[model samples]
Target: MKKYLVVLVSMLGSLSMMGQTNTWVNDPAHSRLGFVVKHLTISEISGRFADFSVKVTTSKPDYLDAQIEVTAKIASMDTGVEMRDNHLRSADFFDAEKYPTLTFKSTSVEKTGKDKGKLHGNLTFHGITKPVVVDVVYFGTVTNPMNNATTAGFQIKGVVKRSDFDLGPKFPEAVISNDVQIIADVEFSPNK
Candidate 1:
């Protein structure tokens, strides 16, 4: 009967909607993308990108099946020192004028534990793309009292070699360590 067919179609549509993926956008006010590297083989220097955007897509509430993408402006690097920051953005290092942005797109996600996972992705920097893996810790989700919006938190940590991307090739290892530690703490809310 026509009535029965319409009801069945509506039921199926609702079920499909329940399984649809949701997109989450990073909250800039609650997120940070930073890095640390050894300076002069004794001290460490830390810096963060001032402009970036992250997007996450998932069909699960736990983020077990999440796909993440990020774009960060290379010229936005801030190390609290204007001279050093400008030098870093020059051709001697990032060459920010040529490669204006760094980007990452997840290839796969492997769950290591209930709240831990390994995120494998392609990181593109300085016009080079390399596969990288980062450890992810899900801090779970909470409802914000101010806006009544559900927000999810995650911390991602990884180590990258500057040599791999041919970054700062002019600087010796003793002057600037080849190893750079990347750390990002991000909060995401469903895209409106």
Candidate 2:
């Protein structure tokens, strides 16, 4: 009976250890936050967050049990044009005052296909938090010579109205769109 008990205990311990997971850190050198905004009535402008991180972990290879957290610095906003960038950081747009960080935390992972999934998470910005769903496309992994890291890429895209976050409606005379599309092209490196 004692030998049987020992075997049972060992089996349970192995299962517990099996639950341990692996993670991948953001390779800042290869990762970036790129976005676009509408201007006037016919033009579109591009910008990016120079600094950000995507912290991810999982026990499965398909990233089925994976979880992710993202944080971007508001002050890193850049639109190529210096003056326009400064104004965006001011009280009119992002108001770099009351809100300084843009964050996202995943709630669940749903498989759409063999290489794709849907991530439903909460996005917090401009002092407002909303449930945002991102269509996630996994671009596989590769060994990078420039950074000497195994990087996995993802194209996380979604649309949310600026007004929903209390960013205010367009000026009575200003020409801009209400809905904002965000493309978070991010990469991650392995961690354990």
Best by TM-score: 1
The digit string of per-residue lDDT tens for model 1 on 62-175 reads 676788999999999999999999999999999999999999999999999999999999999998999999999999899989899999999999999999999999899999
Task: Tell me the lDDT of candidate 1.
Answer: 0.95
| Tens-digit per-residue lDDT, 1-192, candidate 2 | 999999999999988856878788887776777777687768888788887888898877788788888898989988899998888777777887779999989988899987788999898988889998878899998888886878788888777777777664444224666667788777788874
Model 2 stretches astray by more than 4 angstroms: 1-18, 145-148, 168-174
Q: Give the Cα lDDT of each candidate.
A: 0.95, 0.82
In Å, residue 69's CA in model 2 sits off its true spot by: 0.6
Span of ten consecutive residues with least summed lDDT in model 2: 168-177
Error of 2 at 123 (Å): 0.5
